[model samples]
Target: MSKVIEIQDSQFNDEVVKANETVLAYFWAPWCGPCRLVSPSVSWVAENYSDRLKVVKLEVDASPDSVATCKVEGVPALRIFKDGNMISSHEGAIGKQGLQDFVESAV
Candidate 1:
């Protein structure tokens, strides 16, 4: 499977909450500045947690319906899921350290 998976509005229901293990979903958009800044950190955490966590990216601009459901107030919202349930979510850009911590706890 691919290292990074893109989850759109259509796939959100089936891929996210129903996932088998932990999920680090990055709700982002191309026009968002903070989203761009923290993307690499997200990717790094995803790679590091590959065995226990699943990371998916959702482009907010491309998925208005999904964004509405998430009710994201800002860019780069990181939601951690465990046992197919959202355990916690970190809003805004947490950079590398925060991302690593969130993923570590989720997994």
Candidate 2:
């Protein structure tokens, strides 16, 4: 099983921005109800799509600077990055199928 990498502000640039592979970042806050609802699907995507995508989890509360830089206005936001640039983003909780589609479309 693949693990969702926990990202912090300090390493945001090195981990996500300059990542060698396509990255899917799940930006969430612990207090957000919707974020909790999307957790499992995020994990599933991490494990299932490990071959082609790099999955990471970022806590908005802990990584404030990174969140601000990403311009994330809400929790449960998913962003896809490739070649050091954000390629796509989705704001809201979604199911496994939706996550698969999100990643597939970006790739």
Candidate 3:
């Protein structure tokens, strides 16, 4: 099973922003092709780095509040959060290695 947690706008604050540990928030939409392409890498990160990172996914269409709050203008957006603040973000379909590097850089 995938380790990534599916979150909605209502849960964003409590689940991510208020979390004590580092967070990886993935923003995507059901119709976004690039989102599908990048999903495996996200899942890989969730499984491999579960000890250090809290991985969560928010559907763009379903979670408009979160999308706007994070300034996510595109699908497959990955935002790294620490201490209730966004530390880094990338908008696109980054491959497995690239995703790994991205997460590593933050955590």
Candidate 4:
């Protein structure tokens, strides 16, 4: 599988909430500066933690339903889901170490 999968509202349930393994959904928007800053770290984590986690990107503007469902008021939201439920979430541009800590703490 790819390091990161671009997710849409229609696939959110089957791909994320019900995923067998832990999933990190990175919710972002095209115009958000913070989102851009956090994107690389998200991808890096995806590649490094391929076994422990799954990273999926969700564009807020295109996925309104998921954006609302996830309660994302801003871009660069990172939510971790396991066993069909959300375990943790962070809403801002976080660095590589911060992202690592975020995932490590949850898993």
Clash pairs of candidate 1?
none
User: What tens digits encode model 4's per-residue C-alpha lDDT throughout 1-107?
Assistant: 35999989999999998899999999998899998899889989999999899999999989999888888988799999999888899998899999999999978
* lDDT, residue 70, candidate 1: 68
Greater lDDT among 1 and 3 belongs to: 3
Best by TM-score: 3
TM-score for all models, in order of appearance: 0.90, 0.94, 0.98, 0.96
TM-score of 3: 0.98
CA-lDDT, candidates in order: 0.81, 0.90, 0.95, 0.91
Model 2: residue 21 alpha-carbon error in angstroms: 0.2
lDDT tens per residue, model 3, 1-107? 99999999999999999999999999988899999999988999999999999999999999999999999998889999999999999998899999999999999
Candidate 1 per-residue lDDT over residues 6-107, each given as its tens digit: 878889878887888788888998898998899888788777788888889998888888677767777888877777667888888886987887777766
Q: Where in model 1 is the C-alpha error above 4 Å? A: none
TM-score, model 1 to reference: 0.90
Best by lDDT: 3
Q: How many clashes in candidate 3? A: 0
Question: Each candidate: RMSD to true structure?
Answer: 1.7, 1.1, 0.6, 1.3
Using TM-score as the measure, name the better of candidate 1 and candidate 4: 4
lDDT for 6 in candidate 4 is: 97
